[model samples]
Target: MIRFENVSVTYDGSARPSVRGVDFEVPEGELVLLVGPSGVGKSTVLGAVSGLVPHFTGGTLHGRVTVAGRDTRTHKPRELADVVGTVGQDPLSHFVTDTVEDELAYGMESLGLAPAVMRRRVEETLDLLGLAGLRDRPLSTLSGGQQQRVAIGSVLTPHPQVLVLDEPTSALDPAAAEEVLAVLQRLVHDLGTTVLMAEHRLERVIQYADQVVLLPGPGERPLLGTPAEVMAVSPVVPPVVDLGRLAGWSPLPLTVRDARRGAAPLRDRLTDRQPRPDHTARPPQPAPPTPGRRLFKRTKPDTTAAPPVAEVSSLAVRRDRVQALRHVDLTVTPGETIALMGRNGAGKSTLLGALVGLVEPSSGSVRTGDAIPHRTRPRDLVRRVGLVPQEPRDLLYADTVAAECVAADDDAGATPGTCRALLSDLLPAVADDTHPRDLSEGQRLTLALAVVLTARPPLLLLDEPTRGLDYAAKARLVTILRGLAAEGHAIIMATHDVELAAELAHRVVLLAEGEVIADGPATDVVVASPSFAPQVAKILAPQHWLTVSQVREALR
Candidate 1:
């Protein structure tokens, strides 16, 4: 259904092609997953299918791209709308209407479908994507994950023969991601729909792909094969595949079930050896003495003791008619890492907003250090806490990367090269002159994180920190965050990436319907919940192995 012949794309400013010698054929009714590291042109490749690359993006395309027998070179995006539906990484940019129901119906209306047919398709999409409850909600009022669902439903409602998605499940929670993937599976198997998706979270979708397209790097020829064949040689792979490689299992397992079937002997070897203690976990500190009246006696204060970085008591937040948060209580201490986890619209982001002063509590209280967050001044708040919001672009305003870094230094009173240095460490390939708007989703996220880190606040908050990051970039982030935690900085991240939580979080705080549902050590909380458990944990069930690194360490 889709064919790329000697394809290469180069933007106006670039000297070399972003992706070169990319040649592949995706059969009709099959799901093809595009896998690669950040900046390897996965999005560019997806754009070519929908004719968004050279047509709307102002790039030069070499060779031919055909979809459903129509040459994409001749067919613009609007011209191919009847047969193709595309959803990019940022869902907010994809919406033309304010409400969920309207957004879903907009595509069919544009296609000039019958009103009755449009209504029926809209309802079917809403139910398929689990967006029935949110049908009436405004796009702005919904959570990031909810917006993603609406974006997908909008494209799905048109009933196009081909769906081209970029990071389709990046913003979704575990359950929501599963629902979306299942919908795609149904489309491929029952309806004979074609899907071409590029995603950084391979663990969630690799098992479901009919074939895999591996883009090694920029200007490199692409590799096309079965999922197992590609993953065997792919640098970026899911934990289940990594575990299979470590165990020397033939034909690396793509799913948890397959890995578990071959993990009996490995489990036996780890039964006696305990996993290493979580480095993010802090030992209990000695309690301070009770206050007593020292009549006219002079005494020195204890400078060694550190107070909690953030304290929340009976915190309640309301957005529109929805009670976003309800009587939630959380405490953050220095040198601690916590993962805020739950389903989509679970009040995780709202809680982070409350901490960073972005959302005012309807009732109760939120304190960062000594000041109430909502009442504190922005200048003063920057020194106490910093937040990297779910939409990283919201934090960027400058025209170029260097300008943003310079502005970050000035705003945070940091050293001249502070932000740039951090960005270099996190992602070295981004150029100084590149526009912040032009960077990929993962690169934008890294830049935003660097901007926030320049402040070096006592407490740090991140919402969906690994949204578009590949495994290498995520590992660099883990290292940077670990160093910060070691230096007595408290980190609270609202995320749906269970693997990230397993690798970095000392504790997991699970929220549901604007209330705390589970709170404990990361291993305890994640292992207890089947939906939130990482691949390794699911494979080595009854053994409490949360990550491949832990398993590797134990075996060694």
Candidate 2:
């Protein structure tokens, strides 16, 4: 249904082409996953297929790019709107309507469909996408997962033959992410709609894909073939895939359920009816802190009973009719690192917003030692707490990275020399005079971090710091945050990256529907929560090994 032959998209006011001589094809009814680190032209390819590359994005197109036998270079987005539906990485930027029902009808209205047709189509879509119950809710009131679903339903109402989504679940918690994916899977299986999605979280979507397309950045061609074929070549493989490789299993396990089925003895072992040695590996971990373990550190500053640095009690927040958080309680000591995780729409982000006093709790409240968090001003919050939003560019605006850092400082913390020194470490040799927004996605995210650090908040909150970042960029972030923690900062981050959580979070808290379901040390919590369990090392030994480093250390 889509074809690109030596396609190169050159953007205006830029020398290098965004996409360089790329070639690929997606046949009808095939679910092909397009994956690479951010800014690798994956979105450009999608735009080309949907007739938005050279059209809306404003670029000179070279070579041939066609979708469903129609040349994209000649057709505008409106002309191809009926054949292709595109949803971007962020849903907020795409919402032009107020309510969920209106969002779904916008696309159809643009097509000049009849009112009768629109009503019938909207009703069918709402039910089909499980959005009927949420029809009257405002788009702003819906959860991240619900918002994305509305975005999908908006495009899919016309029943487009080809559906393209870019990182649809990147911002969602695990559960909310799963809910949306299930709807997508149903659309593909039941309606036979062709799907082409680009995503970073491979573990969640790889199993459902019939074909995998691995796009390696610059100077490399796309890898197209079966999931097993492409994963073997990619630098990283999903955990279950890695397990299948190690276990000498046939065909391969695409999902945990697939792994269980093909491994042959998993269910038998669960029933305590197994003789196979492979079926039984490690003991299941427990819920709370183990007695006598140093789960948290203590210090003697002055007073004998000053209590913890951060505290939450019976906190609750309601998103319209849905209670995003309910009677949730948590605490963090000075210098402690906590990772927040849950299924998408499970309140991970909500809890983080509560921590910073953004979402006023419906009842109960969050309090920090000598201060009240809710009553604090935004400027005061920044001085005491730092946050890096999900999008890199949201916080960037200054002319230069150095200037961006200086803007956060009140002429006290950020001197000209200090700003230069901070950029030297955070962003290397990024030109001090270059526009902060002009840099690459990773560079922009790094620069944003430099700005937040200028305030030097004792409490730091990072929301999905690894999104759109390359491996090298992610490492630099981990290093910077680790140093901050060592220097005694209470850093809390809401993230979808379980591996990062395993490595960085001194404590891990599982948030679901705005409740703190699980909490404790990182290793202990990960071992208990299947969602945070290590795919490779956990399968390898499963004993006292929550991470590869632990396994390596034990082996040594």
Candidate 3:
């Protein structure tokens, strides 16, 4: 059981509390989902449960937080480790060991559990999280999604009574996310474990929550109720709930099954009308006629006749003993938006690395524009392509937000304040003096994206672009990307967010075991695969409606 009584948290530099007047009780053995927009203190709220807020984060806490009858105020994080297991948004920061098996057993070792019990629990967690194959892999060598599962398994192995997770499934692929969520469900139902999770991808987890805690904004009192009750008025909601609202369905559906049950008449309404093609509504703009320096300008005569911005042929990449990519081939053209999708460790990121010259292929060839990517200089590569990696911190080095923007401008040879302007467009009102490390995961991601976009490369690569973004922020991103695509920028994003692919991608390329499994139009690829389909697509099955906006467009 968890209880928060009149809780408010204020950091050392802040004038107002990040969260205030937040009083709630989460019953034992129940899963509570914390929902809110970015910067509304969802992470701060989760930190309070594990006593990381005022204790380690150097914040002032008003009122009380108790977990399993133990007062968090009196117990530090290490003191409460026996009962509370916390995983933050960044999983790389959570690991203390080198390998997966060691990381999973580290928690129990810290707790002074019996070696036999720790070993048994570690094996169980590895199997539960689908990490058995990755047990011997180094933490650094694994993919982002794999690291997330390892982070979760580390906590679960301790057999703590309470699990406090921040964006637990943000990095995972559809099937892996389902497996992790299913394990959590089993823990909640069969073992009476308590889970308090905050995730921006509400579509993946909203249906599984036992209760919902809605944080409207900073310092605002939270709204606690059943999932349907909270989603009705909540500012952030999944597509299924949005469809229910549009159809005027009583008690908004939380899952795809519920929405599909009532979708017959809505399906009839859309029978004659076709959903608009993704990213085709905007008219194409002509190139500036400035060769090499033109950003988002289509110099090609036509779509079918356009030359490829990046070309890959028989690409093979080997990292350690694993063949990260195997004989993969692909092509990108100006104005095309492609989504690279597959399960965790499926070579999506490795392909992006090949594009940006981060990973050298073991065999075969990769060419961006006219230069071989792995052999091209960084300065030369910036003009042809830019990549915002899965970990945004890799692109940021400055002490403050303003410094990073200025550095980005200098590095890209762009006009002063260009990166800042882009950052403002993506996420408004980030302070100039705020440290890059101090910003939330979503904010950091926005800053990193701004830094990459400053160069305005003809081709852009984004890995997990919507990891921590709320719906509003993601909409802003979609608009920005749409504008770029209209101007003829070729975009390739490696992501597991199916809703995002449905909303923005013109093409979908599914990879498996470091090979391309399927490549086709976005609708054709996602609508056929049950695991990859978005909520609306699943509900409107046999109809091919991929998004709520598509349905709204058809009706209008």
TM-scores for all predictions: 0.96, 0.81, 0.97
- Per-residue lDDT over 424-531 for candidate 1, one digit per residue giving the tens place of the 0 to 100 score: 989999999999987899999999999998888878999999999999999999989976776667889999999999999989999999999999999789999999
lDDT (Cα atoms) of all candidates against the true structure: 0.91, 0.71, 0.91
Question: Using TM-score as the measure, which candidate wins?
Answer: 3
Model 3: number of clashes?
Answer: 0
Give the least accurate 10-residue stretch of model 1, judged by summed lDDT.
Answer: 287-296
lDDT of 1 at 289: 23
Q: How does residue 126 of candidate 1 score in lDDT?
A: 85
Q: Residues 147-235, candidate 2, lDDT per residue (tens digit)?
A: 87788788888889899998777666565567778877877888878899987677778877888877677435677888877877676
Q: In terms of TM-score, how similar is model 1 to the real structure?
A: 0.96
Query: In model 2, where do residues sit more than 4 Å from their true spots?
Result: 114-117, 120-124, 127-129, 241-254, 257-307, 318-323, 361-365, 391-393, 399-403, 409-412, 415-446, 470-472, 530-544
lDDT of 3 by residue, 1-556 (tens): 9999999999988889999999999999999999999999999999999999889898799999999998988999999999999999999999999999999999889888999999899889988998898889899999999999999999999889999999999999999999999999999999999999999999999988999999999899999999999999999999999999999999789999999899999999988888875552322433312334433333442434456788999999999999999989998877789999999999999999999999999999999888898898999899789999888999889999999999999998888888988898889968999999888999999999999988888789999999999999999999888777776778999999999999998889999999999998887898999999999988988888889998887887
TM-score of 2: 0.81
User: Each candidate's root-mean-square deviation in Å?
Assistant: 5.2, 6.8, 2.1
